[model samples]
Target: MHRFLLKLSSCSLRNSKFQRLILPSLNLFASGSPPPPSANPYSADSFRKSRAFSSKSRALGVRCISSEAGREAIEYDVVIIGAGPAGLSAAIRLKQLCQEKNTDLSVCVVEKGAEVGGHIVSGNVFEPLALDELLPHWRQEQAPIEVAASSDKFWFLTKDRAIPLPSPFDNKGNYVISLSQLVRWLGGKAEELGIEIYPGFSASEVLYDASDKVVGIATKEMGISKDGSKKETFQPGVDIKGRVTLFAEGCRGSLSEKIIKKYKLREEVNAQHQTYALGIKEVWEIDESKHNPGEVVHTLGWPLDPKTYGGSFLYHMNDRQVALGLVVALNYKNPFLNPYEEFQKLKHHPAIKSILEGGTVLQYGARTLNEGGFQV
Candidate 1:
């Protein structure tokens, strides 16, 4: 089943007919009962109108606003904002279509990060379904996707005891991968496809004409002072105009936030509510005796109250390395609770302590994740 899906997914990528592709999602439901009832369909429509009025009322807060002279404008067939998985994949597929159809098209991807993967962090164990569809021969091309999952360990922890539990999670064809490395690899592929990418250029405002229709974006000006004064070396931003502007700026992009409010895009039931999870992770080089490459461990129910939803993952990577992370609901109670401290508590459990005792910390980082569901 895994290989069959991979082959079919690769064919989809090769075709590059994005408009014809049906984006599939997998949703799971509990076994016992059907859902009670869904809210009225137009409930979203009414909610949106109220929210838009409220959003428009709060226009007093503004920071670092600027209208500098000498802005240079560039034209492209397509302007992609962001260099992450979605944006890069879009750029690749667009170029692929141009070549396949024998048409001339100019494409550029504007990235905010100093480099391709400079700001990317993710839980490394990944399903390569999309990767297979985007880069069919990624493995043959020496992409960084290696270290197939070998084992799974699920635990339910208490204050002092660690109990094993049966979990529904499956890892048959998944692999452990560094998202940063994966993104860098994708960036390389994009550059090879002749997609011009400008790093360190943050898209500040969505450019619009008198009609209020988005045409492109303007990059943020550089060399600004702390008091909003232009530095001696201030340079104006670029106005990259395109027929279509695609915003793939992950969860927390400024332009995305503005557009969401301006267009009232999240008025629907599922889209209106969002819950964030704060995950703090560290890579440690454990003793070789404790290293079990491709081993994934997940635990829940301890170091946190039942009301405070949380979990932890310990993925054993290659080279005696273990990536440990703890995720806690951003809406957690206990106002004084510290996210990093909670993760530290997660490590003190006997099950996790054993593997990390003699380990040396390699890297540490934290990121906020949008754990919100989407509805049609």
Candidate 2:
């Protein structure tokens, strides 16, 4: 009877919804999603009741106004630091939240770069899930994705040859993009939503009120480029206060670290993980005979013989250009393993050489990647 009952339970578990719920939990543990929150039914109830009460109070004609004037330092409803993906996403959410509450919540975004894309660097293959959900009709509006990747090639290489390895998700691959273009587009969308984005302004310090809550930010004066040269004039610090300050500075975020330490936000940065890699890249005008219009080739091994954690990519973008690059982790024991040499050696490979044979390198640059993969 017990065996029969077990079989019946197994059969019931085969239902689609049951599998959907169970599969994600199993995968979450397998993929390192955080454990469920501790039970706090009373606190949860109180939180919901408080929000409802706030909504009721808001409807009772409670107006939220800054205590100071426009010329004077005024506090915003929301202030976000760093204009990266994380910061922009937070701003969008805050806008939505304010809209739902029928409140005129002022938002200010502080960016340090000359423009939004100056500090951004990536060999980015983006899955447009977030973009599609956030900005519907993105494609119809001519989104900045360089190439919609339909194929992904993972090649394991020897000194002279390469062998393709079957990928786990060969059926679905991500789209490739020039990260700078995408960032500029995202900044435009944020601005369209009435989110005041101040580029070329560096956030130097955070301001806290008497209760030790983050109330505002102190921005450092920035040098703006004039007709042909940089101007060395100092602009006075502008203080923009807010109810909440969200720091979305990307990897090795200085301000984020400072705030975390000052507030003791979590016991010693719970996201204590590190993975660093130096990416050396060059854009080349592809030789017509060798160019496969929309191909993206990725390879591992070869140039990095002893190192098991390095890879190379050659992506064909629009405008007859190809982005060729190699990323190698700095954890290798060899103190003198040159990434530039590795990149040059990769170009000499028979498979890689034939493709880039007559191509002329247009630009050369390098940047660091935070490969800690969502630890924050």
Candidate 3:
């Protein structure tokens, strides 16, 4: 799914047919600026009215102050939410087009994390094809992509033994990587291409004009108490106006989910229901003698019953570090089943315990993911 998003975003800028298919849904304007009110759904008067007198603004006690008295507004040709691979790729592609055409295009990316890669977590056995297309010289740029996968191992685990299976995992040319590190590297490249990135700013609301066309986003206000009172340090969120707004909030992102429902994005997909999975992952530093830097392992049929649709992955990465994780389908029938506890049980299996008995855990995290590939 990550690869697919990256591929589409990297090529979406100059592809007119693709733009015609997707840009209208995203409310994007052409030629790096919005069209006049006569040709566009948005009007200057309606934009101001929506901002100053919308129901939400009224509920929040936002006054109809003059432009000079309201929160500061920054305008851009494009505004991207989330600094993940997809968003950064789109921003970089737009800037590249600007350089090639000798035209100016303003681009802005907002990330909720304190830093570019702080919120990213994945078991990333990475396929480098997308990266190769996005930046062919990434190898020369010193990207943190090391530890090429050397082999694949798949097993069917019993309580006491691991029976080797005909390995379906074919990671011969992939890499076991820290996805956060790679995303940070991409963020640096985006900045080098003159893209403006604002980390630590969470996009709280999707801004729309009177005609219901998306115009931009509003950042979350700070210094608001849990009881809904403004603190002494209260400050209103800034309004980021853009000709086009891209939401790359990743799997099940809050705003993305809202947008999807609002637009019935999945209604046309033959009524295919979205499925989710809970992924629990851990990184460990193991003894040098026991470490195999490029070995990849995947297992099935233990800890989770046959009825549950789930699996586990263990990848040997660089620096004597091993990344392991368990994915459990959210549709499990057992109401009392805990995914984290199940992961703990998985590590105790004979096949997994041998490698981890003497290791030290470095990091642990869990996140929900889109289960059945990239849908809608």
Candidate 4:
């Protein structure tokens, strides 16, 4: 029954040392191979020409070869910070443009997770409009987009009763999906398009040019002891420089946060601080007879008070599986409020209990969501 929306704000970073440079539109897809600094529009020369950059004495060059710290380096036309949905999609689209124009554009995606989707946690009721635009033949390609959403129900719960309400969620053509599985599939597609995906390699720092523009990122150094001494397996992080760098690391990503702070991205007029919510989710294998694929039930006004902004979701997925979760606003006044305990209590309610009575817990995880409405 909750509305899902993405709000993007335009911002500029103008200071005595840093010039006002507009964030390049995501819609702009460059073609051809990586070019020299003077030939590249995203380079320092062009930044100065556009009056978007000021000189600095960092002594960092355009090309990222081996560093003084003995870290190896690689160059690409585009470098993506995350291998999640946004990062993979961007890499795929860039490669698609390369194919269409018969050009060679090297793209790289760095993921901190052990695998492509290992860290992704979601109560995903997926709408495929973007997928349709990116890959029109996704269904034909046997993508894991099974279990079309068929029914939606909303409930107002009390201590002992479950009252039906007019459902605000209409997921007629959407799909109940495991977001992690889908992300892995998207990773495969990205690889097929020749996008280099480096899993298990966390980006530790954003590499910048002498003009303070982001050139790429440096991966985290591995095999360090607690005392900060190098172990036998010590391997220096690699420097990945690119003509254009994209930070697709979801909301509140480490590197992304650094960039936001460095550029003062949220200093725009009348900006509101970003709010958050903790989403605790679990996948259960329910009894075959009790399973109903594509049945989505949302509940409100039971575990949480009327003043609190939060709800619960129970999505019936394929293979007699059910995915349920509780979202609790992090800004709650009560210091004693425990989201995990609240979720356990939510499962005991008559409405939710009946469905999950004979179910076995398969997997569970928790993650944070951006809840600052129309301010992100």
C-alpha positional error of residue 79 in candidate 4 after TM-score superposition, expressed in Å: 0.7
RMSD to native, candidate 4: 12.1
Can you give the TM-score per candidate against the true fold? Answer: 0.80, 0.72, 0.82, 0.82
Model 3, 2: alpha-carbon shift in Å? Answer: 8.0
For all candidates, the clash counts are 0, 0, 0, 0
lDDT of each residue in 315-375, candidate 3, tens digit only: 8888798888999999999999899999999999988999998999888887887877446
lDDT of 1 by residue, 61-118 (tens): 1111223435556656788999878888888988788789987466768788766766
Q: How high is the CA lDDT of each candidate model? A: 0.68, 0.62, 0.73, 0.72
lDDT of 1: 0.68
**Candidate 3: Cα lDDT at 168:** 75
How big is the positional error of residue 22 in model 1, measured in Å on the Cα after superposition? 35
**lDDT of prediction 4:** 0.72
Q: Least lDDT summed over 10 consecutive residues: which range in candidate 1?
A: 3-12
Cα lDDT tens digits, model 4, 1-376, are 1122221111112121111111211111232122344343322222123211112101112233565556667666788988777888888888888789887676778788756777778878888888988899999987877999999999898977889999988888898888777777787788677665666668889999889999888877767899999887566677778889999887788888898789887875446888988888888889999899999888888798777789988888887988899999899988888889989999999888888998898888888888875654
**Model 4 pairs in collision:** none
Which pairs of residues collide in model 1? none
